[model samples]
Target: MTDDPAATFARARAAAGVLFFNDNDQIMLVDPSYKDYRDVPGGYLERGETPRQAAEREVAEELGIHPELGRLLVADWAPSEAEGDKVLFLFDGGTLTKDHLDGIRLDPGELVGFQFHDIAHVHDLTISRLARRLVHAHAAHLDGSTRYLEHGEWI
Candidate 1:
C-alpha cells in the first residue's frame, strides 16, 4: 500500500526448527513455557547466523542435546494474518535413541518439557500452520526429499 519501493518490499522473518524422531517413529515436541501450544525445538536467527546454525543452536539451547541435522525437510514461505510474511525451515534431526532422550534437559525459562508425540496427534497440539508444515516435513523425511510449502501447503 506504499508508493515507495522500500515500503513495498516484504521484510520476511525467518525461523528454523528441528524434527527428531524416536524408535517408535513418534516425533519430538517441546512445551514452551511462553506459549499455549507446543512447538518443535527452534527459534529465530541471531544476528549474522544462518538458519541451519540457528536450528542447531536452538536445539542445544532448548533441549540440551546436540545432534547433527540429517537433512533439510521443509522450507516454507508462510504468509498469513496471524504470522505475517516469513520463511520457515524444518530440519531432520534423525532418530533419537534412549541416550538422546535421557540427555534432554529443558531450559526452564524457555521450555517446560519434551515428549515424543505420534505424528497423527501432533496437529491437535500445535498451531495450524506449524502442524501443516510438520506434516509435510515428516513426509519429506520418509522419502528423503526436501519439500517447499507456501503457507503450509505443498507447492
Candidate 2:
C-alpha cells in the first residue's frame, strides 16, 4: 500500500473493530484462516448501525459476550486493498474473565483462533496501522494520560 497519507485517507472506507479487553488489561485478537496474522474482532459496519453498536454485536457474534465499550479510544481513516476508504473505530472494552471468553463461538469463515495480548506487544504484530493506533490510544486511556487526536489528519 502507498504511504502517501492523503491518497490513503481519500480512499479510506468505513469499518469497525471490536476492542476486547481481558481481566489482565490485554486486548483480544482473532486469527482468521484467510490471513496469516491475527487482528481485533471486527468488520465493515452494517447499514444503520453505529460504530459502538457494531463493536458490541461483532464481539457477541465472534466471542459470545456483550462487552461494555468505553468512550471512543481511537478513530482513524485508512485504505484497504479489498475495500477502500475504510474508517476504523476502536473502543475500549472493559475487563473480561475466562468465564466470559468461554462463551465465545467462532465464525468459521472469518475466525479460527483468539488470544488476549498485551497492548505493548500489539505493535510488534503484523496488524493494520489503524489497529495499532487503537491499541495505543487504549493504552494511553488506561494510563490516564492525554494522547494526540488526529481528527481529519489525512482527509
Candidate 3:
C-alpha cells in the first residue's frame, strides 16, 4: 500500500460518454492531455449535477457538441489508483458525423487529439479497465443484452 492519505478509501465518481457512430461506423474518442490514454468524451461529474447532466456538460465543454445521450449501458463500481474507490457510469449514444467533430471546441487543458474508430477497434484506446468493461457493455447493449456485475466482481 502507498503512504498517500488520499488513498485511504474509495470515492464515488460519475462519468459519461457518447458512443456516436459516423457514416463509416467509427466511435468518437479523445486523447486527454493529463493522461496517455484515449478515453470517451466525458469527465467526472461536478458537485450538483446528475450523471446525465454531467455527461451533457462534459461533452459540450470538451468537444463543443451536444451529445444525444442514450441508455444506461454500464453503471458499476471500480477502484481508482489515485482516488481509491470510484463508481463509474457509462451511457449509450448513437453514431455521429464528421461535421460534429469539425465543429467541436476542445478544452486544450484536457484533450489533445481525437479519433473515430470502428466498434471492433475500441480495444486500441488504452483506457482504464472500467472503460473496457463499458465498451464491452456498449456492444452488449447494442445486442439488446448486458450482463456486467456490480462493484465486488469488477477486477
Return whichever of 1 and 2 wins on lDDT.
Answer: 1
**Model 2, 45-146: lDDT tens per residue?**
788888888888887776667757777666775555666556777776667766777777898877888888787787676465645565566665687542
Cand. 1 TM to true fold: 0.93
Rank by TM-score (best first): 1, 3, 2
Q: Which scores higher on TM-score, 2 or 3?
A: 3
lDDT of 2: 0.69
User: Local error of candidate 2 at 81, Å?
Assistant: 5.6
Model 3 agreement with the true structure over 1-155: per-residue lDDT tens digits: 89898987545666655555667756777888987777777778889888888878888888888857777666667666777656666667666656776788889988988877766766566655745665666565678654454652433
Q: Which pairs of residues clash in candidate 1, taking residues 3 or more apart in a chain or in different chains?
A: none
Per-residue lDDT of model 1, residues 76-148, tens digit only: 9987777788899999999987787888889999998888898999779899989999999889999999999
Per-model CA lDDT versus the true structure: 0.91, 0.69, 0.69
Clashing pairs in 3: 10-85, 11-85, 20-94, 20-95, 21-95, 21-96
Error of 2 at 27 (Å): 1.9
- Point out the higher-scoring one by TM-score: 1 or 3: 1
Which pairs of residues clash in candidate 2, taking residues 3 or more apart in a chain or in different chains? Answer: 11-85, 12-85, 12-86, 13-84, 13-85, 13-86, 13-87, 63-104
